[model samples]
Target: MTNIQVLDNPTMHNLLINLSKEESFTFREIIEHTLESFSVNGERQYQPPPSIVNRPNGQNTLFRPFTSDTCIGTKITVESGPDGQGRKSPPHGVIVLTDSKGNPTGLLSSNEITGYRTSMNAFRFLGERMWIIL
Candidate 1:
């Protein structure tokens, strides 16, 4: 069994911020990975529709499973209705990653990364358009 590295919100936030720097090696690798995912060979990456479950307490849980050449994992997020005071809670989730051999490798807090990941697509799109305009 592989040792699982658990990264909470602060750690995950810091890691993502560092990795997102313009000069970071990991950021470049992430771009390469994103581009590869659109390639013919990488088209086989699997991501199925998420499973949603409504809890008795009015919270909905979503499990989104995906697999890549290197790892398989699921991101579980909970969506809660507004409280009695009419204030909605912030979205929160966790990502569980396992190696190709099925060993649990890491568990990451998805709160920050979820937004970061979403913004990356927009950034990538703008970057491509900028090159075209130039």
Candidate 2:
């Protein structure tokens, strides 16, 4: 049993904002971090394919595990289908962070991070091909 610091949406957002200010983080840092992971000379870690489970309540849960040299963790998200009125439920998730020794450290809400990562990837792709588009 490991003690995990669970961070909710507001807390996660505040932490990210604080961190960005303290470290002067920018979108370029996101792209660099992603590129570094896939570099030819960088150490590649094993990331098993995500597993999805469909519940009886019309909700699907996805569990994705990833590993790096310093840490490993899993992201679990639940997607609820449309309701009786055809209104879709917003997806929610948490990401568990663990140290190299497999000790759980923190559990963060994944909504913000997911959106940020997605947008960053899209920006990276477009930035790399801006000349062709222009």
Q: Which candidate number maximizes lDDT? A: 1
Per-candidate TM-scores read 0.78, 0.73
Model 1, TM vs. native:
0.78
Candidate number with greatest TM-score: 1
Across residues 1-134, which tens digit of lDDT does each residue of candidate 2 receive? 45778889998677656655425347557646854774533444466678999987688999988787788888999999778987778999999999899988988999977876676677667877996788
Candidate 1 yields a Cα-based lDDT of: 0.79
lDDT score, residue 62, model 2? Answer: 97
Q: Write the per-residue lDDT of candidate 1 for residues 1-134, one digit (tens) a residue.
A: 44999999999778878764665446655856854774435554465667999977678889988777788888999889779987779878999999987789999999987777677767777888999999
Cα lDDT computed for each candidate against the true fold: 0.79, 0.78
Checking candidate 2 for backbone clashes, the offending pairs are none
Residue 22, model 1: Cα distance from true site in angstroms = 4.2
In model 2, the runs with Cα more than 4 Å from the true position are 1-4, 15-45, 131-134
